[model samples]
Target chain A: MNTVWKENALQVIQDIFRNQFFDDSLAITEHTTPADIEEWDSLAHVNLLASIENAFNIRFTADDMANIDSIAVLLATMVERGAC
Target chain B: MAEPTHMLMMAKEHCKAGEHARALEVLRSLASRHDPLPMQAQYARLALTIAQGLEGLPVLRVAFLAGSTLDHLVGALRFWLLLEGFRLEPYLAPFDTWRQEAADPSSGLYSFRPDLVWFFLTARDLKLEALWGDQPQQWQEAAAGRAAEVATLARQVLATLPATVLVNNAEASATRVLGNFEGSVSWSAASLQRRYNLELAQALPAGASVFDLEHLASCFGLERWEDHRLWCHSKHPFSLEAHAPVAFAGAKLIAAAKGKARKCLVLDLDNTLWGGVVGDDGVDGIRVGPDAGAAGEAYAAFQAFAKSLSLRGIALAVCSKNDPDLAREPFRSRQGMALTLDDFAVFRANWDNKADNLRQIARELNLGLEALVFVDDNPAERALVRAELPQVAVPELSADPADYMRVLAEGAWFETLTFVEEDRSRSRAYRDNAARNACLAQSSDLDGYLRSLEMRACWGDADQARLSRLAQLVNKTNQFHLTTTRYSEPELTALSLADDAWVGWFSLSDRFGDHGVIAAVVLRFRGQAALVDTWTMSCRVFSRGMEDFIFLKIWEVAKGRGCTRLEGAFRPTPKNGVVATLYDRLGGSSVQQDCGQESRWHFDLVAPPPDLTHYIADANGSGN
Candidate 1:
């Protein structure tokens, strides 16, 4: 993985989650899963994905949506697609 | 709360200064426009500003009964309606329980008594999947059946309370499971959904309107509009970015239905309407009309837009801070232009404040200041009018002339429920009215001038042929009589056919042109007296003596139907005091008076005033 790209992507994703979930101080690590955050419901997850796409200028396929259950999985998918 | 954005800070300052409306203006512009701020950031930034602290702003209670979860739309709708100066009070019915909530009298929907009820349903809600491979017969039957089913739900809510209802037709799924064959086969989901959409619209109860969600989705591009992933995960109807546009459009539609539509568009000259200042750049130098190439085409397109508005009954006027002669030069000598000087009803070119000029335009047109919308390219002028005359709409238009039409069209300032035949002549009628008023000012002999005008009055029942015009007048007229009620078409239809009721549509025209359905009145017969249910007339024909002419026919018809007396009432609004003494002038005696509420009047059929004189003659040439 590109260390700089991974660091920047995580920062963007963290800000989106913080803003959309109305928690100004939310933090996420690569190990975090959907089960760890109660507010990471389907509605918020969909909104989060859209916000990331808008911020990163990328599109996500349906397979990516289904496969990305954890932050580690999300990073891995981004790395595999060279989005990172 | 997070750090407030610059626009949010402006809203907060306005709130602090007791300028809640101004605050809404800032926030609404931020949300409605395609701003640089991302959707999630914008939505998150505006979440806490639901404005519950503001006092005395007009409130609109809205209930959303949708097949899918609408938690996000409710928030965005608040920001949109706030721009229209209404605080939203939303009641989101439980997911997919719309049928139950609408049917049960004791449901929260009925108890909440929303001013507007929205029904957002889709193909899945119609249960077309059950008929999947079943024959083409079930496709047709299911569409009709499901439409009737949902229409019944709407009727149930309407029966309990009087509210504006908007139903969303089913969207044709983009999946295209049968690929290109979807268009060819009647059994395809998309084809069946299209049929369901048509049936749903046709089956809706009277006064209810379809929201055209399918068209909206198509405009947004179906690929971007739908997300099967979100649908499967949470049953979200459309994409998250779709919410803002939907809410903005939905608010404009509701505003139109509530009679908040604009009647006049006031344009600014110079670089605003065309390219370059007329004083600096002569008619030949001014970049307008098609002769001027690309930049000129932009101005011509904007000019074409204003012309189209005039053709559709929206009065146009010119207010420029330049010399009158120079301002008139462009429209007079310019060739290949989309507009002419004759297009404008009122033209004032002087160094007055544009805000006061807008007021003068409204005064000359006999319309309220609320009826006018000011468009100017100068930011200072826009800010000035927005500050001085808050009632007149000043859109946050982009500086680029190429974007003017898109901005204006998206603003949806001039929306109407129905278009009457008279709308085609409405702008021209305003122009002619100026001539009539000028004639009124110059003539020493009022009676001679009135007689010389040669006015004609046509009267008829509000039958199917005239129902649309009748409904248009009733909806547009706020206060032309004792009671002010905007009746729907179905209600007007029932009244016209009722044996014990007499409803009339009055059309008046002089040598100028035809004024279609200028006035309409409804009366209910009970015992020996006819009670006036509603009597509304367009403000355009005021002072034309049409009132007396219509009153004469009212009594003639009432007496023929065995009525011995007539009862009416006078309700006062802030601006309708011009007609405060109307019933008195019509020879009606005060029966009861309730200060600040209503005043009742009674007129005996044994005698109408012998001196009730009008210059208008019957269309049949039977002048009595």
Candidate 2:
């Protein structure tokens, strides 16, 4: 269940970031963080989370919103919550 | 305060001359902190006039409260509304304030009192979290619970606020938990969104409308619609590219809401109405109906749609550049043709320029050119009409023959907020007027013609049944209206019951047919004088001595009330100048040559009314 959810969540996140950066070659992985992307600021982070919530038809709680700082943490949260 | 009327026209001229910056400066000088005009239509037209060639229009007071960041969407909506002759001053509520603004009358939404209030909330704002890890049954329950909250808010707004509330349906994100198989499950996002929309629609009261944002996003494609970058930065769900289409839908709805809907459709023939030009292809050779290929079928479908418009009360007319007989032969002879000669109120198939022809049609129908929507398949003809007669709405048609019907129908120019029984019979009335014109043309002596046609003016008090029609006349009649003061139906009803006021409408019918209520008069008794508050007559009855008949009726009513004098005024508008000499012709002694914008006249009721004895016989049913 974790593997399928993680894979789907990772794909949705990567699609959003790629469009954001306007670079089809931009890549994402478990370790990717805001420091890895120059355009990833606090404003961009909220927009990213909102887009993911809409695309995946799920929501992030206050705890999940604060704790998810990287791609791996975000996907893990979705997988553990069964939201992907 | 609003700018003077002359200044507004000067700014419009500057815009027409392509001095957009100058026009903007002119408009800015007239800007007020409050709503500029007392009348909604006047404000809309003024905004449209000043906004020409400008990047953004004068923002009307519109409170936009939605779940998503809608800066770009509002920009697009504002521009689109301006194009459709509206400029909304958008008051964007803070995020998550939709409920608070709607439920509380003391909120900024009510304080601002926007002409239009738009609410756009996404699934996340409602039940996204509740649906997570939920089964089909659980999903249904969550959707129902959330939708009820939205409905309750809508009801509260409808009760508390006087603005038109526009609520957008929720759009499901492209990410599907169940993928393609989600359709089979009730727990799916699509299912939740659909149910939410249905419930929301049922909850909306009158004065509230639904905007299908989901369908609009689909038209723009879901992939392009959801911009994660913009959404992350600003919470804007829609991309910049999607703004035009989104704005267009909202603008069209607003135009209809304000009763600025186009009234008449002036069509062209040959390549426009059929697959081929009738003059060149001959009557038998022209393609129409389903049997003729795809193009012919499209033309036939178009005719059927035009026929439907006629039935719905939209006046149909023809202004084609063709021989008269050839222009009308297709409608008369073609078995597949959906429309007939009688469908059109005016048929002008001559070598005259289309602009002149359109003017003639407007005159014959007693309609303003601003009320006309000209449709032609020919680009050159369309361009000519657009340039020469700028007031007439000339929509550009697609070059493809098969696209003609869809292009014109999708415009939805003939929009209406309310439908009346009289709308269905509007074309028949115009047809009757055409018959009257035919009789007038054949007669040599004008009096003999009027006498031969058995005419009767039925005078009666305007009751509740005729209030809507009377108000429409008051609002729309321009050419023959003296003191053109538009009134609402409720206002007219109040006047009818007022002790000092009297309101009456007259229906004119001749040997040809009934012209419906062709004249209306409003009088206010002050001391020994009856002030003619309003005297509006349909231009169709011009030169038919209907004015004389109405003058006589007004005299009788004034005398009955023991008033010694009947006072009248003629206020000049661009179209109403035709009635400038009306009071003079009625034999009223000039009281004031200029009372600001209007000229005043009065008649002594003790002295007899101008030689209307000839009309007395007709009023008593002797002429017939």
- What DockQ, on C-alphas, does every prediction get? 0.19, 0.03
Highest-TM-score candidate: 1
Quote fnat for model 1: 0.14
Tens-digit lDDT track for model 1 on B1-624? 233466766765676577765666666555543443355335433433545656765688999898897866776777677666678889989999999999989999999988888987766677675345778778888778888998998877766666778888876677766788778877777777888888987898776788888887887788878877667656778877777777778878887876779999999988877899879878888898777877789989999999999999999999889999999988888875788988999998999988888888888888888888888899999998988988888887787899989888878789776766788989999998877877888888888778767899888787887887887777776657557776767668777889888889888888776777788899899989998878888888888788889888888877878888988888887666777898988888898888787988988987853368889989956546
Q: Superposing all C-alpha atoms, what RMSD in Å does each candidate have to the true structure?
A: 5.2, 11.3
Per-residue CA lDDT of candidate 2, range B273-310, in tens?
88788889899889998878888888888888889999
Quote the lDDT for B225 in model 1: 80
Q: How badly does each model clash, as a count of residue pairs?
A: 0, 6
Off-target runs (Cα >4 Å) in candidate 1 are: A1-84, B1-4, B10-30, B33-63, B87-94, B97-115, B123-161, B170-206, B479-481, B555-565, B584-595, B604-607, B620-623
In angstroms, what RMSD does candidate 1 have relative to the true structure? 5.2
Model 1 scores a TM of 0.81
